[model samples]
Target: MGISPELRSLNLSNNHLEGPLTVSSIPLQLQSLDLSVNELNGPLLLDIPIPEQNFSLEKLLLADNKIEGPITASLGTMTSLYILDLSNNQLRGNIPDSLGNLTLLTVLRLESNHLNGEIPACLTNLSELVMLNLASNELEGQIPKELGNLAGLASLHLEKNNLQGLLPLSLAQLSNLQVIDVGENNLTGNIPSWIGTCSSLLVLMMRSNNFKGKLPPQIGELTELLILDLSSNLLYGEIPNTYLNLAAMVVVNEDMSVVGEDRHAPSARRVRPCGAPSGARSRHPPNIRGITPDSDHNYYGTCVDYVYGNEDRRYYIEGLDLITKGSERHYAYVLSGMACIDLSNNRLWGHLPAKIGNLKGLMFLNLSRNSFNGDIPGSMGNLSQLESLDLSLNKFSGKIPFQLGSLDYLGYLNMSYNNLSGVIPQQGSHMITFDKSAFWGNPNLRGCPVESWKCSPPHSPLSPPTIDVKEEAKEGFSWYELSMGWSVAAGFFAVVLVLTFKVNWRKTTFDQMDRAITFLLGERTN
Candidate 1:
C-alpha cells in the first residue's frame, strides 16, 4: 500500500512537551509547526542529524520555553527556514554566524533570551531582513554601518542597550527608513546636519544619550518631524531660533533664539532653547552687567544710571519733579547690607516680579502698597539674605511661595490685606513675627502669624489709608490762626442770613430768577 505524499500543518503548542525536539518525526512536507508558550524543557537538541543540503523545514516556533544552551552550528543546516521564532527561552551564548548564510529566510526572531556578546555585524548582509527589534537585552558594542544598506527597512528599534559611538553618516543611505529609535544609549557627537533633510523620517528619538554640540540650525526644515526628544545630552548654547517659531509646542519662552532673557536687554542672561531649572545661572559670560547677588552692581557704585534721569534728586515724588541735588535735607540714613526701595504707595499696577530675589544683599524690601498681583515667584526664597519683605496693601494672591523659608535672614514678612492663601511659609526661618493684622483681610490665609505681632495686630481698616507725611505736617501749620480770622468773618454772615430770611420770607420765584438773569445778562450786554 502506497501512502499519500501530502503534508500541510502541525500544532504542538502548550502541550508541555519536554526534552529534545524530535525533528525526525515531523512531517517531511510540514509548512507550519508551533510548540510555543509551553512547559518544554532541556536543551533545544535537533533530533534529526540531517545534513544542511537535505533540510526541509519552512516555519518553526519553539518560543516561551525553558529551552537552554547554545544554538548549535547545525542551525545553519536549515537552509529553507523562512519564519522562525525562538523567543522567550533560556538560550545563551553566541549566535552562529553560519545562520547568516540562509538566503531565503525573511522573518527571524530570537529575542527575550540570555543572548550576550556583540551582535554579529555579518547579519547586516541579510538583504531581505525587515522589522528588526533586539531590545531589552545585554547587547553591547556599536551598530554596524552596513545597516544603511537595508533598502526595504522601515522601522527599527535598538533602544535600551549599551550601544555607543557616532552614528555612521551612511545611515542616511536607508531611503525607506521612517521610525528609528537609537535612544537610551551612549550615542554621542553632533546630530547629523543632514538628518532634517530626510523626506520620510518622521519620529527620530535620540534622547538619554551623549549627543553634544548645538542642534542643527536647520532642524526647522523637519516640518513633519514630531516628538523630537534630545534631552539628557550635552547640547548647549541658545536654543535654535528655527526650532522655535513653530506652533508645535505650547510652552512659555520657547523661542530658542539668541533671544534676550527679558526680550529687551542683552543685559539679561542668554536663556537657551532647553530650559534651565529655576535659579539656574547661565555661564554665558554672566551678563556681567546683569544685576546679581554677591555683587556690587545693585549698590556701592556711583550712579551710572538712575531710575529717574536724575536720581541726583535727594527727595522725589510722582506728582512733582523735585530735584534736590545737593540739598542738605536730601540725606537719609540707610544701613549697610539693608535694602530699602520705596517704589511703594504709588499708582503702580501689575504683579511683583520674582526677579526681586536677585537682591541677595537685601535686608529689606518694601513694596508695601502697590497694586501687584500673582503669587510671589519661588525664586525669592533663594535670597538667603532677605530679612524683611513688605508686600502689604497690594492685590498679590495665591500661597506665598514656600521657598520663603530659605531666607535665613527673613525676619519680617507682611502680606497683609491682600488675597493670599495656604499656610504662611512656616519654616520659622528668620521668622521674627507677624500678627493677624500682618496678614489681615486676606480671607484665604491660615496658620500662626509671625511671632512679633500677636500682642496687637494692626487693624484692617477698610483699606490701607495713605498718609502723606508732608501733607499731614502742612495741616498742623499755624495756618489755623488764619482760619480763625475767617471764622469771625463767617459769624458776620450768620447774622445776615437771619435778617434776610425773616424780612423776605415770602419772596416769589419769578422775582429771584428775573433779578439774577437781568444782572448777568446786563453785564454781558455792557
Candidate 2:
C-alpha cells in the first residue's frame, strides 16, 4: 500500500468522515495531505514533530470541515510548510501570526470563518507568498498595500471585511496579478490607472465603497480579462468607449450614466452597498434608488459588457466610476439583450430614448426618480417582452401610450408622481392587481377616478349625421321645392276661377257701364 514507508501523498476529500483526527501513526514519509470538503470535527492536536519524521509537508489542505479552536501557534513547527488552506469551517479566534514563520509558505487561504482582528502586518514579510484569501471574515483596518510588493501574487481576495482608506497606489506593481476582489469593504479614492495596466489581470471587484474619480482608459487593453466590477462607488467621468467591448453583468449597485451609444459617465447617486436599504431586500445590481424592475422581456438583443463591482450574472467590467458626478444626465443607459437593469435612486435625466426598444430582451427596467420628460414613446410597444416597468417620479407629459398594453408580461407598473396624462395602459397582469396608487398624480389620465378624487369622465366619440343633404337633393328635390310646384298648380286653378268670375263681373260691368256714363257725373260727385 502507498501508506507504507515509501508513500508520499494522502488525499481524503468530499467524504462524510467525522470525529477527531490525530496523527499518532508511525508512518512519517508523507509529503502532502488533503482532507478537505468533509464533515470532520475536532481540533488539530498534533503534538509530535510530524515534520521531523520525514513527513515534511509541502502542502496541507483541511477546508470545508468542522475544525474548531484557535490555530495553534505550534503550527510554526512545520517549518517546511509551503501551502496551507483551512477555509470553509467554524474556526475561531485570531490568526496566529507565528504561522508566518513558515518562511516557505507560498499559498494561504483562511476564508469563510470567524477569525477576527487586524490582518497581521507581518504577512507583508512573506516575500514568497503567491496566493492569499482571507475574505468573508471579521478583519478590520486598512488594507496592507505593502502586499503589492509580492510581485509573484496571482490571486487575492479580501472582500466582506471592514478594510478602509484609499487603495494603495502600489498595487500596479503586481504585474503577475490575475484576480483581485476587494468588495464589501470601505475602500475609497480613485481607481488607480496602474492597476489597469496589469497585463495578466482578468477578474477584479471593488464595488461598495466611497471610491471616486474616472476609470482608467488603458484597462480596455486587458484582452484576457473575463470579469470586472467597480459598481457602487463615488466615481465620475464618462464610461470609456473601450469599456463597451467587455462582456459581463455586474451584480452590484455601481451607478453610471449611459451618456450615449459609446459614451458613459460617472453619476452622483449613492450606489447600494453590499447589503440593501431598510424594508427593501437586496436585489441584483445592488440597492439603487430610481431604478425599478422589468421582466419577461421577449426582446433578445445583443449582450453587452457590464462593468461593475458585483459578482454573478456571468459578466463584470471595471474601469468605470459613478459617484463623482452624482445623478445628472445618466439616462438612455442601454446594454442590449433581454436582461435586467435596476437603476433606482440615481440622478439620471432626459426622456427615455426611443431606441430603448432595441433591448428586446429587457425584462426589468427601472428609471424612477429621474428628470425624464415628454410623452412615453409609442415605440415602447415593441418591447412585448417587458414585465415590470417603473418610470415614476419623473416630469413626463402627454397620455400614457396604449402600446404599453402590448406588454402582456407586464406585472408592476409605477408611473406615479409624474405629469403623465391620459389612460394608463390597461393591459397586463398588474392592471387589476394595481389601483390608483400605480398612476397617482397623473391629473389628465383617463379612467374611473378614485372615489375620493373628483376627476370628470373621459370624453366620448361623436356620432355622424344620418343623411347627406346634397347627395339626397341630387336624387330628389327638397320638400319645400316640391311644395312650390304644388303652389304653382294651385295658382293656375285659382287663375281659371278668377277668369270665370271675371266674365260674370265683366257682363254686369258692361251693362252697368252704359248707365255708368249717365250716372258717372252723379257717381263722381258722390
Candidate 3:
C-alpha cells in the first residue's frame, strides 16, 4: 500500500508500528510526519539521506517511541521544519547543534531522554522558538543567556537536570513567556527580580534548588501567575508582603475566559500523568505543530495524560501535578480554577499576611518547615475551597483559629511542631478527623485528639503541722490551762518538801499565807 508522494501529512502515531523509520519509505513531498507512541527503535537518521534540494518537511514528531542513539546532524537539512519533538524516548548523546539551523522552528522538545553533555547554545539561533523543553535529561551546564533571544517563547521547562549556575538575566526579555520550571537542579544565587518583567507569567516553579536570599518583591508584578512554588530551598527572610500585590492570586477569578481557549493552538500542554509526580511517565508527549504565525501563541494549557484503569485507552486534560493531601494529584481540565501557593521548607519568618485570605479560590496552601511565627491568620478561613493546609514546623504561637474549622472542604490539616496553645478547635469533622500527629508537638496546646493535660504540683511532707485552737478550748483540758495546773501542783509539792526539810522555810511560807488571807477579807468587807 504505497501512499502518494504528494501526501502532505502522514500521521502514523498511536499505532503499534515497529522497526526503524527508513528514509526510502518517506515521501519526498511530505510536509508533516508523526511517528510517535510506537515501538520504533534504532539509530535516528543513520540510513536517512540528506537531500541536496530544499526538503518540503515541516513538522517531525518521533517522540514516545523506543528511538535510541544520537540525534543526527542530518536533521539540520530540513530547513523548513518548524516543530520537532524527539522527547520521551531512549535518545542518547548531546543534542545535535546542527538542528539549530531550523531557524523557523517554533517548538523543540527533547525532554525525558538520556541526552548527556551541555545544551548546545547554538540552539538559541532558533529565535522563532516558542517552547523548549529539555527537562528530565542528563544534561548539565549553565542555561545559555542567549535563550533570551527567543522572544516569542511562551513556556520553557529545563527542570530535573544537572544544570547549574544562575538563571540568565536575558530571560527577562522573553515578554511572551507564561511558564518557567527550573526545579530539581543545583542552581544557585538569588532568584532574579527581572522575572517579574515577564508580565505574561502564569506558572513559576523553582523548588529543590540551592537558591538563597529573600524572594524578589518584583515577583508581585506577575499578575497572571497561577502557581508559585519556591519550597525546599535555603531562602531566608520574611516573605515579601509585596506578594499580596499579586492581583491575579489575591482576587478570585471566577471566569478564566481571558486566558484564551485555543487548545488547538501550537503551544506546550505539559501533560502530567495520573498518580505521577513531577517527572513521571507523562503523555500527550508535548504535541508539536506548526502555527500559522498570525495566531496569538499566548495560552499555556497544561494537561495530565493518563490511561484509564479499566481499559488501556489513554486520555488527557488541561492541568498539572500538585502535592495534595500528602500525595500527587492530577487536577483535571479546570486548571484555570486552581490556585496554589507553596513556599515551605525555607528559612522564611514572620507572620503570614492576612492579605492571602483574599484568594477565596485558593485550594492548596503549604507554608511548612519555616521560621514563621504568629497566629494562623483567621482570614485564611475565607478560603472556603481550601482542601489542604500545612503550616507545621514553625514557631507559630497562639490558638489555631476556630475559623479554620469552618473550612468544610479541608481534608488535610497539619499544625504540628508549632508554639500554638489552647485547645485545638473542634468545630468541624475535617479538623476532628486528623490524627494526633497533625496537632502534636505544641506542649501548651490541649485538645480532644491530642493528650495534653495540665500537670499538678506535688505535696511536700516536711511542712509544719497546723494547730486547732477551737478544739483545744472545747476540750475539758485546754492545753494552756492544763499546763498551768501541772506547774502549780509540782511547785506546791516542791515547797512542802522544802518546808519539811527546813523549819525556817516552813515559818516564812505560813506568814505569807496569813497576810494574803487578811488582805482578801479586807477587800470583801470594803
Q: Backbone clashes in each candidate structure, one number apiece? A: 6, 48, 2
Best-fitting candidate, scored by TM-score: 3
Model 3 Cα lDDT, one tens digit per residue, 135-213: 8899899998889888878778888899999999999898878678898999999998999888777788898999999
lDDT of 1 by residue, 1-526 (tens): 3324564456788876777665565666665678888877777667456573365676678878888888766676677765577877888887778777765554466766777677687667666654455544557788888877776554466666778888878777776554466767888888888776664443465766887776676655654333344544666543354543222221122122221233122221111111122233222211122234332222210111111122211111001011111111211111112222233343345655555554343343555555667787787775565555677888888987777766655556677888888877654432325445667778877655633333222343654433435565687745446667899999989877776786564355447888999999999999
The local lDDT score (0 to 100) that residue 284 gets in candidate 2 is: 25
Query: 1-526 in candidate 2: lDDT tens per residue?
Result: 3367655567788889788567654245565677889997878777666556655666677889999887777777677666788988888888888877877666778988888887887777667666688988988888777787877776677888888887777778888676677877988777777776887655566766667766677766664343455655665544454543332222222342211222122221111111222122222221222333232111111111212223111111112112211222212122222234344443445566665654444455666665667878877777655666778887889987777766766766888888876655443423434567878877777654333222322231453333434666888776556778999999989867776779987677678888879798888888
Top lDDT prediction, candidate number: 3
Model 1 misses residue 320 by how many Å?
69
Worst 10 residues of 1 by lDDT: 314-323
Model 1 root mean square deviation, Cα atoms: 28.6
Superposed model 2: Cα runs more than 4 Å off: 25-27, 214-221, 236-238, 247-526
Task: TM-score winner between 1 and 3, please give it.
Answer: 3
Sorted by lDDT (best first), the order is: 3, 2, 1
Candidate 3 residue 56 Cα shift, in angstroms, is 2.3
For candidate 3, the TM-score is 0.73
